[model samples]
Target: MLRADNLTKKYGDFTALNGLDLSVNEGDIFCLLGANGAGKSTTINLFLNFIEPTDGQASINAMDVTLHDRETKQLLSYIPENLMLYPHLTGLENLDFFCGLGGKSHTQDQLESLLRESGLQADFIHRRVSSYSKGMRQKVGIALACAREASVLLLDEPTSGLDPKASNEFSELLLTMKKRGVATLMATHDLFRAKDTGTHIGIMKEGVLVEQFASEEVSFRDLEKLYLQHMHN
Candidate 1:
């Protein structure tokens, strides 16, 4: 449901991404691993149409994102490092409002159920978002995806600051989404999460994809060694 064909992005003479070719089919979780300035976020932004690509194409469900911005956006959900919701609004209210923007309407009970399924505690659902923790806010993002019945999920550093337990919870939610045939494209620095949660993995260095493989093809220790090898070189 997601594809990038020789995707390239540049700022002045510096290329932020170079010849990135990738595909994430329905029911697939593709994790991108890279250090800072490795073009992971640039790839996400291009798919989001947040910035126009300097060359090549980024598409969703075979439709070029740049050409079908509105329609493509309707088919996908994005969760950045920090999800921004109205601090004054309760979690349920935030979910409802975002779902409404996507043309999805649900009863209050249904909305509450969505949050519950996303792993938000029932008591906290009605509480103001300002009182919630980072993990709680991210569960709302998951709920938003479920409510919209989104076909694609684009996540940038979604687990960056979460504690191990919270990050594990988020990964479990993603696994549930995968069972529902949601294609996920996530850019993260967490190797263990990427290996444990992803079906496919790619490593990027200096804006180029240096290695790509199936998660089950290697041990976590080997993956770490390989990643470290690249970083050190």
Candidate 2:
């Protein structure tokens, strides 16, 4: 579970995020829809403790992230827009290394199984990451999340560059995580994908959360119209 209570962040005269209140519970995929500088990444950074909040709190599983940085980190996994992995290492090798950083040790078979469950092909699991497409790298990232048993996942622009097929594949993978009780908070520009995969959708503009609703309550066209209205306002 993830919660942000009146979270605020400011950089000198510029307010990056202001009074953000959000919650993502188990089995929830919350998608944040916003353009550049809409405070989406700032919200995530605050939750990750990558940057401290200027006001209020960012919590994971009811523990304040600022007060329990290490413990909160142990309960979550993050995937940024650009997933960085050891390019020369095989997918399995990368999974093991990242998982190890989280103090998770897995055998070759166990690691491979995680990758497979993350929607990776067995043939590519042993291949070096340098030869992988972005989608492949992201699958390994998901595997690392599973290997760590992360209960919360924070994703920022995860489907930015993937083709439709790969994007859909990634969406399916997220549904799998949801079924396993992983709460997900994702910042994405793909409205269609958000509608397809998110349980809740929020529109943010100029550092404020302007609109939010259950995905099924609004059609995709309605969501897009509301999003554009907020962006223009």
Off by over 4 Å in 2: none
- How many clashing residue pairs appear in each of the predictions shown? 0, 0
Taking all chains together, each candidate's TM-score versus the true structure is 0.99, 0.98
With a 3 Å backbone cut-off (N, CA, C), the pairs that clash in candidate 2 are none
| Candidate 2 positional error at 171, Å | 0.3
Top candidate (lDDT): 1
User: To one decimal, what is the Cα RMSD in angstroms of model 1 from the true structure?
Assistant: 0.6
- State the TM-score for model 2: 0.98
For model 1, residues 24-116, the per-residue Cα lDDT tens digits are: 999999999999999999999999999999999999999999999999999999999988899999999999999999999999999999999
Top candidate on TM-score is: 1
Give per-residue CA lDDT, model 2, range 124-201, as digits (tens).
999999999999888888888888999999999999999899889999989989999999999999999999999999
The lDDT of model 1 is 0.96
